[model samples]
Target: MAHSRGKRRLRTLVRNGWISDQHGAWPMVILPAFVGAQLAHRGSIAATADTLAVIDPVLATSLPITWLTGFLCFTAIERWALTPKKRRPSCLPAIITWGTIATTTGLITVIRSPMLLLWTPVFLPLFVAALWEVLHRRPRSPLARLTTVTAASLMLPVFALGVVGAPSPLRTTPELWRATAILGSYFVGTVPFVRSMIRARSDHRWEHASVLWHLTSAVLILLATIWGAVSWPIGVLWVIIACRAWAFPRWQRAHGPVKPIIIGMLEIVLSIVLSALIILA
Candidate 1:
C-alpha cells in the first residue's frame, strides 16, 4: 500500500509539472508565428514568381515546428521552476526532461539558420528580465507579463525572417514591424484588460487603465492606417477590439464574474480573427 501510494504521488507531481495552467498563453504563443509566416509567404510570392522554388521545403516546414516545440518545453520548465522549492525536488524529472528537449531543439534551430543569431541581442534582455521575474516569483507581475508578451509578439518578425530564408544582415521590411506593432499593442492591452476582469476586478483604477489603453491602441491603429502602414480594414478590426476592451468589463460588473473558460474561449476567437485580418491585409 505504501509503495502504491508513493507511485500515485509521483505520477501526480509529474502531471502537474508537465501541464501548464496558463490557458490564455497558447494563442499568444501561436498566433504571431502563424501570422508572421503567412505574411512572409505572401511577400515572397509578390516579390518573385519563383518564390516556392527557392524555399527549402524541409527547412520551411521543420523550423517553426522545432521552434514551437522548444518554446513549449521552455514554458513547462518555467512553470516547474515557479513551484515551491520544497516541492521542486519532486518535479525535477519533468524539469530535466523538458530542459533537455528545449536545449536540443533550440540548438538545432540555431544551427540550421545561423543568421537567426542576429535576434539574440533583441531577445536576450527580454529573456533575462523574464527569468528574473520567474526567479523572484513574480511571473504574473505586470512588467513580467509585458516582457513575455513583447517577446512573443516580436516573434512575428523572427518567424518572418525564418520563412524568407534568413537573409544576411537580417533585414525586416516595414510590413513586418507594422504587424508586430499591431499584434504587440493588442497583447499589451490585454495585460491590463484581463487584470481588470479577474485579479483587480474591484480596482476601478485598473478598469480605467484598461479603457485608456484600448483607446490609445485605437488611435495608433488609425494613425497607422492613415500613414498606409495598415489598411482601413485592419484599422476597423482594432476599433472592434477597442470597443470590446471598453464594454466587457462593464458587462462583467453588471452581471457577475464571467467564467475564466469563457474569457479564454473568447480571447481565442479574437486572436484567430486578428491573425486572419492581418494576413489578409
Candidate 2:
C-alpha cells in the first residue's frame, strides 16, 4: 500500500534524523487535557486578578491558590513543551499555540478581560511560523497545510483587529490614526524584515540591512503610541518576540543567516520588554 505524503514525510524525517518517535507525541493527549482545564481555570484566573489588584497593583505576593492555576499552566508548558529532546520532534508549535490560548484565558482572570483585550497570542506566533514556511520550508503535514491556510486568512486580520479592537485607553482621539500607526509600525516594519531578502535578494546587504532594520523597527513598535493611554510598550513588543515563531525553521529551509539572527534578537528583546512592561505597568 502506498503511504500518504504525510506518513511518507514522517518516515523520511524519522529516517534522516529530522524527527523521532519520542515523548513530544504526548501533545496528542496533553493538548486535549489543557483545553478542558482552561474552561474551568478561566474564571479562576480572571477572578483572582480582579480581586487582587486592589491591595497592590503589583500583586507580587498572593495566596498560593490565587496564583496556583496560572503558575501550573505556565510551568506545564515551559517544562513539558520546551523539553530539549522533545523540542525538535513531533509538532510542538501546535502545542504552544494551544498554550497561548491557555495563557490568554488565565490572564483574563487577573486583568478583567481588557488587559490585552484585542490581542490573541495564538495569531502571531503561529502565523509567523506559517509565514516562515511560505518564505522557507515546504509544507509536510496536512495539518501544516491547514495551518498555513488558516494563517494566510488571519494575518492581516490579526493586525487589523489588534488595530481596531484597541481599547479605550488605546483610542482616545476618536480616530484610528494612532492605532493605525502602531499597527503599521509592527506590520510594515517587520514584514519588510521578513521579506527583505526575498525582495532585495542581495548578499552582504541583506545581512547588514536586516539587523539595522530589525532593531529600528522593533524599537519603534515598543515606543509607538497607542492613543498615548495604553503604554505597555514592552509587553506589546514582547509578544512580537514570542511570536517570532518561524525564525528557526525559516533559517533551516532558506540557508540564510541574517533573518534568523534578526528574528532571534527580536524574540529576546520582545520577551524582556513584554515581561517588564506587563509586570511593572
Candidate 3:
C-alpha cells in the first residue's frame, strides 16, 4: 500500500508538470540569477561572498519558487486558456507554489527590497499572456512574443536589485542598465530564431529570416564594440551566435538536432557562455 501511494504521488507530480519534462526551462531563472550576481559582484570573488552571506537563504528559497511559478503558470494556462472545457486545477501544486511565492516575496520584503516584490505584479500578467500564447498554439503571435520577451527581459533588473541588496533607483548604476539591455536582447532575440526553427523548419524564407535577424544583431554588436559601448569579447560572442543562427538551418536539414530539446540545450549553452563572457569582459 505504501508503494502504491508513492506511485500515486509521483503521478500527481507529473500531472502538475513538476517532474515530467526537461526542456531547459530552469535556465530562464538561472541565467539571470547568474548574470545578476556576477554583475553585482563585478567579477570580484570577495564581493560575491559578502553579498552571498546575506542573500544565501533568499536565493535558496527563491530558486524553487521561481521554477514553480513558471511550471504552475504554464500548466494553468495550458489547461484553461484556449480550451472550451475548463480543466480542474492542480490544487496541491497550486497551493504549494503560491505559498512559496508568498513566503519568498515576504522574505524579500523583510530585506527591504520593495522593487523585488514589485516584480510579482509585473511578471504574473506577462507569464499568463505568454502561456496563453503557448496554449493557443500561436507561437508566432505578436502578443505572445511581446509578453514572453518582456518577461524574460525583466529578469536582468530584478536580478540586479536582488544582488545589490538595496532598493536603489534604476539609474544608480549604469552598468546594470546596460547589462539589462544586453541580457534582455539575448532573451527576446531567441523568440524569432526559435519560432522559425520550429514553425518553419527547413523553409527557406524562415531560414533567411533567422539568418538576417542574427546578422543584424552581429552588426549591432560590432557597432557597440567599435563605439566602446561593450568589450571586444562581447562582439566576438555575438558573432559566434550569429554564425550559429546562420548555419543551424542547413545543419538541421541534414543532421537533425531533430528534437526541440536538443536545440534548447544548444541555446542554453550559448546563453551561459555569453553571460560568462559578459562578466569576464
How do all models score by TM-score? 0.86, 0.27, 0.73
lDDT string for model 1 (1-281, tens) is 99999888766754556645577887888899888788767774223333333444555766676666556565656766677777767656666776676677567667776777888888899888987887777879887898889888988877777665655323545677778888888888889988988899899888899899989889988998999888998899889988888888899989999887777787788888888888888
lDDT of each: 0.76, 0.37, 0.64
TM-score of 3: 0.73
The candidate that wins on lDDT is 1
207, model 1: CA deviation in Å?
1.8
Residue pairs in clash, model 3: none
Which regions in candidate 1 have their CA more than 4 angstroms from the true location? 1-15, 44-53, 168-170
Better of 1 and 3 by lDDT: 1
lDDT of predicted model 1: 0.76
Ordered from best to worst TM-score, the candidate numbers read 1, 3, 2
Please give, for residues 1-281, the per-residue lDDT of candidate 3 as tens digits: 99999999977665554452334445655677667666655522222333333444465355435544655555444433333444345544654565566566556544655556656778889877776776677644768766866776666666555655544433345566666667667766676677667867856776776778778778987898899988898888888888878777777777765578777988898888888876776
* Backbone clash pairs in model 2 (N, Cα, C under 3 Å; residues 3+ apart or in different chains), count: 6
